[model samples]
Target: MKLKIKNKGDLIRLRNIIAYKVFKNSTKINKFVGYRIPRRKCDNYLVKSLIDITQIDASLIVDEVNYYGKMTMENRFDLLGSGWVRYRCDIKDDFRGQYEYRGIPWNVDIKTGYRWAADYLDENDCIHSPEGVDIKNVWELGRMNYLVPFSLHVLSETDRELQMAALIHYRNVIEDFTKNNPVGIGVNWVLPMEASIRISNILISYDVLKQTDDKDILDTEFTILIGQLVYSHIKFIWNNLEKNIFGGKNGNHYYSDIVGLLVATGYLQNKNVFTKKVYNYAREEFFKETKEQFYSEGGHFEGSTGYFKLVAEMAVFGTAMLIRNGEVIPGFVMERLYNNKNLAVSLRKTNHSYYSFGDCDSGRFVKVVPHGRFLSNSEAESKYLNLDGYTKIYGKAEKYFLEDDSSMDSLIRYTDGLIANTKNDTPSLEAVMVYQLAGKRLNYQKKYTNGNMGAEQNDKKVQISLNLEQSVLEKYPIKKSTELIDFKTQNKLLDFTLFSKMGFCVIRSDKASLLFRFGTNERSGHGHNDTLHYEYEVDGISHQKDPGTFTYTGYPEKRNAYRSAKAHNVPYYGQEQREFQGIFGYRTADNREIVEFTKSAIAVRYRNMYFEHIRRIVIRDNKVLVEDYGKRDFDIHRKMQLRKSPAYGVIDRNIET
Candidate 1:
């Protein structure tokens, strides 16, 4: 591959690449023999407590785990548009499989074959889908999240035969992957972020498996394979840490690198001089980055809800592992994580879902798919009230409650319970592990009345309740357990709840909810040009939506369009809010100032170099009025950016982003 230096950022990144290559060649690192699974040390009381709390269906877990034995998975691909595709693999093969999109292989370039070394491929180039490739499809399988379901089954199942089958499948997968993909080669190793994610899932899977007390699964060979895989991932992440060395804000990729290193080093069995150095380096960076990356208000600096889920998971799990190892976590870390949970609770709708304001790839440290909910719940179409009537097609509405939200909910609930030593919802095996590691009491009682996955608040629920109440100030925070005696008809006033540092203002009542994205226009990584973008819902039905990101680099035009200001529910000018520098970054800036906000009305102003646009929204008698004002000559378009993206690589249609 030829090097193309377009700007200063590229040059600085190239320098780091060169430096990493030299270090890898010059240093002699110690070899990792194998790892001892930490689940073997789990408390029996904690395991049983989680089983009862989650109420996981044994038969469903068995069926899902068996599917992995067939090496088949059902998932959605954004490149091909809607619908889930079933991917079947052969463990005997070298893992060069591909999903055909429009009769063309998605991950494999017909000419190059995909065995290129990490140094050969330029990740930024999208050189035609047929000739090049989108590497995320391969990375998805490499994540190995399916192993988690199998591990959970092994823990919950009673039949010996079923447990054995799950164990066999798990061992076969490890053997196949480690045997085929060596220490460093192939598309799977193209990005260390993938390696980091894979490491975390692998570690969690095996930790749960070891807790099953099944010698058949925790044999010598299995331990060795797991050790080598983890060691390789750790070394790769250490050598290729995604640091923004040239002085810009580091995003989730770099955070994942630190998390991968920290988890691997902390849990690995064989620790030596080299491993100690790696652990220390990762530990130091983890704390510093956690403080810098997140605002005090507990929002990630990237201004994306999807990225917030990712970084939050990393911080929580990393903290849990440290605390388990007798390390005293700083108070600030706990406070920040608490605030993150509060933010998550604040953005949640009455139905327990969140709006996708900016870019969301469904990225998570662990992919928790409970009760076989592979696909999320969505509406076919939503309607909007216009000049004529409520006849305008608003857009496709989607609710993302399964994928990463489950993992976050479990972590937040357990973290609160762990700190306060109270009851919590142990929704996943990992959450149970976090609880068991801390020796927290399992006083959890299932309250199906809440209807929110049986989640209950602990004694330290003051912050969370306060945040939720702050969003809807007229009345107490609505709980599913509360009797809905004509809630929609109640005339309750909802004042605006603003997180000034994070640039999000929310107005919610019993029957209507509105969210606004207003902040400085400049965004670095995983940001969409959505200044003054807003989403409004009436009677729990979405009327306006933010066109979420469909793909990053698969198609450049689509990437630019989806993140542009025109792809949102806002007053768009002829020009974009910021200039797109590359696939992820931006140049130039704009300003969004909130002039006035109240219970009944709100006004916001957007300013760029060219002109200024002001928008005012008022709510009266269950009716909304949207008024836009701008320069006399500057034309404004109130275009409804209505593309629905529930997850990464998934969109409403193939024709659009």
Candidate 2:
């Protein structure tokens, strides 16, 4: 959408953006070059924590690491968790900067294929082009996240032959990338956010390799080569910060750039004058964006649960690195992190999955766990249960299934490990790193009132309990043991919560769980026109589900269709809650309000431009009564033919209205 100043806040943000741009072009920040890695190495807290964690099998770690390591070596990758897609470089064992998607290579023409990152003017349009090639598929390969396991293995494993193989592969892959993808060129360098994420992973893996005992494998030449790579990434990210602050365009991308600066600065052993100034600037922006991007009530301001998990992962690692350097985390920062963790816990279903509400391309700052639906594609069912048009959104015919992602669960476990001073037998390397970086048990309870997060006045009114049988809770227990909840506890009542500011009212009972989404984000492009849309689950199975995001820029029509009101379960009156302006935003709609929310029932209303929708959901012993008090023609109980995008690229079309 074209930028419009609707409020003073918008005007102020725009002014700040102009000023920041002016300063970026005409200050010492512009004159700064980069720093090199120091020979002096500190204690590798991550490696130590991995060794200290309980119940980790040595043989399994070796096998899993080898599996992915060999896959990386063989050029096979599961991009965005959409099954394994393989591409062959024209030159064997070379990073030629060409990429592939579903066996179709794109941006392959040497003359017109890819350009220097600096030459691209309308970068977003290029990346999201409907030219039959998804840039994400290309950028995913450049992220080098697949090599993370090998990096961690070198530090923790004792097998000499295996460790040597991993070390060689890690060095070779990075060296190849640095050689081919120069400082500011190629499709890989098109976006600063991509560069930010890639550099962070590179430094993290490099950190693991540097601390390992194999000194000969990581010799002076390789270390210097890595030093040059880090310098290039830092320079590129500094020059190309995604600071298009008009109309809430800068969400996770800007946040990621700041976090990347912090990580890159943290990794620099020898800090020069220029590196020091950039580091200080990044530290200042990190805390400010925390307040702006995250809601005071604990949820991310952006509407997507997937983006929430992604930003949370970045925030947790950023916070951990800052804490490791002896920086005192501000009280407000701690409160947001803790509250976000609680929200993550609350969003977890009985089967340990979260509902994908907004645009979730399975984006992550880092990947620590090798298993989960996040890494693997959704499994197809033999027989189709085309409920709520589960098949149509995926663009398929009569086949239905939902992909599972546990990255949020991994974050929850990381927070649990931090506070409890234990890993709880979780294999998440990020969790152990956080626990070790904290240096001591974090007193999270002291930040927000008695381990609960929200405005102080509404704390009591926001949470209510409903009685459920022990058998039901046991039947669908959390897959991993986390300190967030004690399965062994005597409390048999599930807690229902309302994050008023974040606009999610969750009602739970013995029979079912319902989630109602209200509110509109003025400054976040991730907000969907899904107001008053509700998701219902019974006995740990999704009876009615929200059709998640498919592809963002690859198919603009599909992107808009997937996020429209008709795609949701709300009563459609042939008009959307808001009109779509672009792939990521909409013309502001009238905000939905909560009318009544109690133990037995929940009511919400959205006053649209054409008509008002007052949806009332009543909870009973064995069923839910969805009543819409609006236009007589609007049917709350209508068997609508909606579409659902289960995975990023996979689709199943098999239902109707």
Candidate 3:
């Protein structure tokens, strides 16, 4: 018996990690992968990917691939003949159309309808899809979903005309932007990170579909053209890396640019001197940035779960591409990714939702599904669209809520084929990977109708089960009822936590929890000016929240309001607000302190220019006792407020953030 590679664990650590080596010919590998996908329906293959990235068994790709295959078979001369001038679009829809610029819901639109039909808008004037029906900012929509329609055209191998029409649309869109919008000008091109993100989408889409195209000869030319446009995008990102790096802002956007460039070079196999140099520089910076952003103690110091979600995505996607391109992931990068997952898991509740602490700008580093959704409500979908036209035209278009996927789940699911953590449950050991010939999903259910299981179907569903050490798993203790127990003779519950390295003091009992933040505060970006701030939750429902970032930069006053100490459970003086240093800026001080911590109570201290603020909070039964001691007494006010766009329910009648 031969000892072949057993699981993803074995494959990940193989002596040669180069996926398709920098200079090696990939034709042989392509041939091997080609023989693999066609034998099964490609839809199920993508369902598995979606299941990993999102906890949904997404069949949208399957629907899309089937539709694209049909559309490709059609020869639409009118669409193919349309030039760049014909592709010109505008945002001059009715007054309601612009709300999608920030994903605001519409009364007449479907839940996912908050999309701009920017690029795909035809003289057809079809803004209504059964999936969603609303107006959106054209450019934002284009950047977010360009790959969805583009991939359909790429998969249309048999019909050159269909392929050409789709290709032409993509070409015209790029041509218009490049001709009119230079490096620093135009809406989409202004931010280098924006351009880089779109480029990453294009490249990833290209690689996924490139292997399975059936056109043996004629279609190859079209791919070459697509490659040319992709190369141009890479060059644009390359030119802007210095600005992104030199500004010295360690942001998710900066990391996005790096991840985009790294993934592109690895997949494109650009052996050019400059491209190679960019790849190497990006590789080193990625590691350094990882260490700085994610603390070894399993904390994301940027101080927001949302930003943590964004950056962790960059790490996962970028690392996956690098390994696919034949690069070995460093041990530290892998471990940090694990730590990143750990922080996310800690925040996760039983329903797969997260605990709110900081700002979440309503989206992710990568778009999980091809449509828009409500981040606040998991049930917000087409069934709630309240429009007959949407139902009539598209016929119960299924709404996919990708935003609900926990970052912890995404990490475990997407990396199923690439790497397996030994730390994972022993039952989840398998080497099964879904394969597809077309850039689409495989039909595992259809193929195995006669009690047969497809080889890819054998790929078990990825369970992101973690054997978290008892220290990391926070649990609530049983507390006696305040009415029944004698106040003086209460039994203390020993479930108090002191995250010393992270600067958090927590006191939790079975019915409620109290958290005081005295940790490192980020002076800029996702950090809030609520150090020494505390929050309270009763029975898993939020009572006192951090007022989390409502709309940073989007709504300036509100952003300031949410980040100000005034919005948290903290005592401050007068009506004077913390100095607003600019967008993404705050006033941070080395004021983190722990005055006292006992079995059932915690005392914390913070010093400002004139006074020292000491707060002692005790959790006994159903009641909380808060005692404030100020060395130099001044007019001090304490508060907590609720979010207008609340992510969780408010169990307490009187709510303040």
Candidate 4:
């Protein structure tokens, strides 16, 4: 960290002193609460939205919370939950805090919301993950979420003793670093995103909790103890932001860290000149990321549905915060945000859950559901059942992005009057969320009321929504934009996006979804090795699933398996794995063209130096026929994935390879 001589090294020196002071003050006990956020004002609509989610009587929320007592089960708890409870078969030693990576604890009890002590170590002084593999970099990043109670407190004001437990847990871990692991030289702290996520959660959650009418809750003895630790966390991250911010490893973690810096500057009132210097950089990085991060079709560039949804959570919260504050966000940023939501809607229409493709750890940021589906991939049997508020946006997102009247009723009913536009009628729930949180609106003078976002406006009080270029209403009038909803491609439901630049395709039909991996250049950031590999989902349930990613980091064998064709259904002619420029990106390869496709079938011809692979596929009447055209060596044979064995004797039925 270069000490800026320009400011007489004051900011640099001050940051250093605070870091040392925080480490110096390490102890079993201390006053924690000190960070203060401006209290937020809420109208009836905002209050209604919160209450409807928790299913708590709006009257009861005025008081302190009762932990997760009132939390809705539809919301996910997967945001920060990881490696806490490893299977006995995967563990070599049953020791507390004996996780393979980062010396963090395993065996986390969800019912109790307590992580075991952090002193457990293997014979080799290394940590392991649930996969029974050595992942030494695991630094208890899962603890950053501290969900159960944190969720309640983030949304409510009182009755939150769980918050105290979480605070104490993290405080002990932070202070334990002095005797156990020192800063910059040890685990957890080695990763910039770890610090960014931890501090960001603390700061943003603190800001949200402070918005409550109960100032008394903020002054509580337990809160003060936790607040000090949060301060230390912020100071630590701020001092090292230069080191942690990703230079070229532009993955989801990069955005997460940059957004954290943005929050520190936007919400944290007190800061030195150095903090402001990095703060400006954070804002610039945010703008840069918004434009380049996701695909034109709104999919996350990470090549994983789970990560895509996770990215959406960050976008929702980040944009909501900036918009709520009347920040003049670039119009291009809003366009991308809506595009993401729109893509999610398209995927959901084909399948209720996010069309889960590629690698998935099932982590979430916003905890859209009260009950989580963490390790389980996308829920298939009950795709729409047991959904939390976030996943419920299938209809609402459709209405919000497409202005389709067909979904307007469900979107309105689901949000409890939050959606639905009334030209001359009273404001609906959607209108309220937009007008209230958006603070007058983003468009210059146009009014945004009722079912329209960039919709035409008759009133002057409500602000019209605009892009950086101009008001979207002028370009896309809501009344006539119904054409957008009318599918143009043969595959109905508006499934798939074709990148002519790369010849990559993502398609969804009544029978299955087909993905042909492509890259813009040699590295498409999240590109994979499977060029013509395709996955089939029967009624949104994976009959043939693409083995997404192996793990975030660690275990070379596992990483290779995930990134290779070993688990993929596609045949790799000459290579087992797609080459990469670095971690989190893939190298370009032979481009495959879709020779033919239809509502119920697709055919592709792929050629390379090693071999020529031609595949023709068709689906109808709950059955599938796939033909790979090439000269056969001798007798023909085939295999099929079946729920039950076929008859003993039938034409081509008993044939085998």
> Which candidate has the highest TM-score of all?
2
**So what's the TM-score on candidate 1?**
0.72
lDDT of 2 by residue, 1-657 (tens): 233554432343344334434554322222232222233421111121212323334443544555565555455555643444344445445222222212223233121243223222235555655444566666766777776665655555567876666666666577666545434434666677888899888777776566664547767667666666666667667766778664644688888998888887777665677667777888878888888788666777777788888888778777766765568777777777777777776676666566567667777787655544312122342222222232333333422213344347667766664555323554555566566545544665443353322433254452223342223223322222112111211233444477766677665655456677775534555767777777756657775577777677667887788887777767767777788887776775665766666655556667767776666555544345555665445644334345455656544455433
Q: Judge candidate 3 against the unseen true structure and give its global Cα lDDT, from 0 to 1.
A: 0.44
Candidate 4 local lDDT, 537-644, one digit each (tens): 455554344444434443445555555554555644444445544445544355455555444444555554444555544444433455455332211121222121
RMSD in Å for model 4: 14.3
Q: Candidate 3: how large is its RMSD?
A: 16.5
TM-score of each candidate structure, all chains considered together: 0.72, 0.76, 0.59, 0.57
TM-score of 3: 0.59
- The regions of model 1 sitting more than 4 angstroms off are 1-121, 125-132, 213-215, 369-418, 421-430, 437-490, 597-602, 618-627, 633-642, 653-657
The true-versus-predicted C-alpha distance at residue 236 of model 4, in Å, is: 4.4
Model 4: CA > 4 A from native = 1-143, 153-185, 208-249, 270-272, 349-351, 366-527, 550-554, 572-574, 577-657
lDDT of all predictions, in order shown?
A: 0.55, 0.59, 0.44, 0.39
Which of 2 and 3 is the better model by TM-score? 2
Compose the digit string of candidate 3's lDDT tens values, residues 527-631.
666666666565566545566553433345655776777776666654323466654664434465664555555666666554456665666554466655554
After the best TM-score superposition of candidate 3, give how far the Cα of residue 66 lies from its true spot, in angstroms: 12
Clashes within 3 Å, all models in order: 1, 12, 18, 37
> Candidate 2, which ten residues in sequence have the lowest lDDT sum?
480-489
Residue lDDT tens for model 1, 325-413: 56666656665676676666667665555666677765667644332233322322221011111112222233211232222454355
| Each model's Cα RMSD | 10.8, 10.4, 16.5, 14.3
